[model samples]
Target: MYETFDDTLLSRLNEPVPRYTSYPTAPVWESTTPEVYERHLSQIAKRSNPLSLYVHIPFCKTMCLFCGCSVILNRRPENEETYVNYLCKEIELVSAAIGGRAPICQLHFGGGTPTKLTQDQLERIFFKIVSAFPLDAHAEIAMEIDPRTVVEDEGAKLKLLKKLGFTRVSFGVQDTNAWVQEAIKRRQSLEVTQKTFRLAQSLEFQGINLDLIYGLPFQTVATFRETVHAILEMRPDRIALFSYAKIPWLKPHQKAIKEETLPSTHEKFGMYLAARKLLLGAGYVAIGMDHFALPGDELVEAFKAKTLRRNFQGYTVLPADDLIGLGITSIGSVGDGYFQNVKELSTYYQLLDEGKLATFRGKILSPDDLLRQWVIQRLMCDFAVDKAQFQLKFGTSFDGYFHQERERLKPLIDLGLVSVDPVSVRATALGILFIRNISACFDRYFHKKEGPRQFSKAI
Candidate 1:
């Protein structure tokens, strides 16, 4: 959505950059062990704010070809029973660590595919969550669904979810183009997506979000235009428009996707502009960097009030002080610490079976980490940071502390992407497109450009 898709600017700015979902990002996490994560969890038990729970469901039947999530394509369907048992054990141990009867305000089930589980498997896992933690009066539960797998049975599944207290559902609709689908091996049809959307709307769902990716193989401005039009017709409550991060070395499945088929930086940028223009025209308010919502959606209201918060999950309406992550390969945050479960399946299971917290790695935020995180979050969500308010919180002059980074903004400043002064720092509409690149100026962890980085291109 910047001023003419400038190839020169793309070349200059496109480099390895974190999505800034977290300052210090995932690559920097270190020196954390199960004992350390457990310590954080125990400490969080005394905090007054309620909890937000992240449950990872890492099972899937097949590959999406373009997925970057931690998932396994389990052919042995019966293994879900064993997986559910282990999840319950983990939840019980974690809940006990939090002193049980802890309050849960938000619950999100994310995965390779949370919906891939059978109805009984889903119920069993849900039962464990409710039994372990007491939810608030209006506790929100959400899950990500794969539209390609939903059928008439999904109607019943949607109804079941509502009965079980889930208020939200997000469907993965990466692209609607047949050729794009073929190139990606997802093969989801527009008709299936329409049916899924209709089913969810007909139920008691409070919100529905459709996930779209901009830089997938075989995706052109022309073909993606039709995809955008088709998505707008569905009129989802929110849209998560993401730029595809091709990290083939990290996600080996992506290695098969030839670079020749992927769109150029300019084309990818143009596709993003086209999609944003269409969504804005259709009355969707841009929520944050990549999310758009209707005027009445909570995200839109939160954005206007400057209360939007970002976590490992994209954008959140709730400013949860603590997030407890359960299940294998999940990440958790408590206070200034972040923890992750064992990535390997067998090891994760063995740890829980031993009645131990399975945290394998983590990092405790430093003073600078927290400060830069605040700056990054503010600039990312609102495209601006109030100099006076920042000083009030951090007890430092914004200009003085960040002067070095401000100097680094010479190119962006010259290109009219951002404007800064003693009073305020703000991004022009064009600048928001380059927000990650601009925010990188303040990221202390990013400069090393160390060993074989896995971050995606900034464009």
Candidate 2:
């Protein structure tokens, strides 16, 4: 792919675009209340759709300069306990709203660091959730962890996670280079990362994922290759090779990272190509835009079968019809709407204290919104859209409906990144690298002239 890369294409495609984790991304969700959220929950109850749960554990001991997530830097154990209690309260409220006993097909705990919680804290939260919603027979339970958090305990925490029915664990190892790690303010040594990986391996976790970031400060092509090679040696069941999104204005802590220290656009492209080549050579299958998994992994199987799905939680093999997000700043997609909890801890507590569900913002998908969502999701996950299927499902001619979008895609088509025909619209192998750019074509809201850029570049 790089053999064809040039300054012209970079200049043309390297524009800010939404990741499309969801259509009408979070930035545009309207002000919403718990009452409206409850109405959405009632819709789910009426449909009796199985649901997935995403619990946000937003506490961290320290802030990493490269982080973009909503997190609280609190060391008080009491704070965590309080959050857990409120989280459980929110869960119970949701359960009652949905008429209780909704089956869960997938459950994931993401951070700040889910493992940052003490074992007791984790257990209490975990039991509260499972007790409210029974887990489906083949449900997938997973959590994200900072390796440094578990390395000191000699896998004690890992064992407890397994005991609590967590089938998967994702270890966050942004980079292996000491200099790069230092620049990012995340100093997990290669040795510590490996030890923690081996610990999870020994526990016989059903699926182990390793996350890496490219285009970070102090990263070079050679250094990033070394990082990729080191992670490949661990042979994680799944790998998420993510591009670093630099939005210092949105995440103030990112200011700690000097822009000059970051890799240039061209160098970042080179780093991705190098890492991707290595992963492919290792026989890992690319699942979606940024995820790779070994042949037997469920994600790979899903990708191959074209049953893969995406959401705020990224790609998943066991996605339920609805996703319920718990905890502050967490976002949920239920029925035809998306909703999120308040971002502040004080506000979160206040809402739950008032016996409310804590929903602060949300979007109700309109008919047009649903159509665009389908188109964007297919382009992102399947890298193509079957025009016939679209017509059959949406009761509209894909080309006729998206005539303007097709006109918008002409540039990508001419660049050999996309192709459209009577039957389908597809991305070439080269276009997968710019999937976000391709998906953005169908996004009616992605206007460069619309205030400040809310997303990162697509290169």
Number of the top-ranking candidate, with lDDT as the measure:
2
Off by over 4 Å in 2: 448-452
CA lDDT, every model vs. true structure = 0.86, 0.89
The digit string of per-residue lDDT tens for model 2 on 208-258 reads 999999999989999999999999999999999999988887899999999
For TM-score, the strongest prediction is: 2
TM-score for candidate 1, residues paired by index? 0.97
Clashes of each: 0, 0
Q: 255-337 in candidate 1: lDDT tens per residue? A: 88888999998899889998999999999998778999999999999899998888887889885778888888788888898
Residue 277's lDDT within candidate 2 is 95
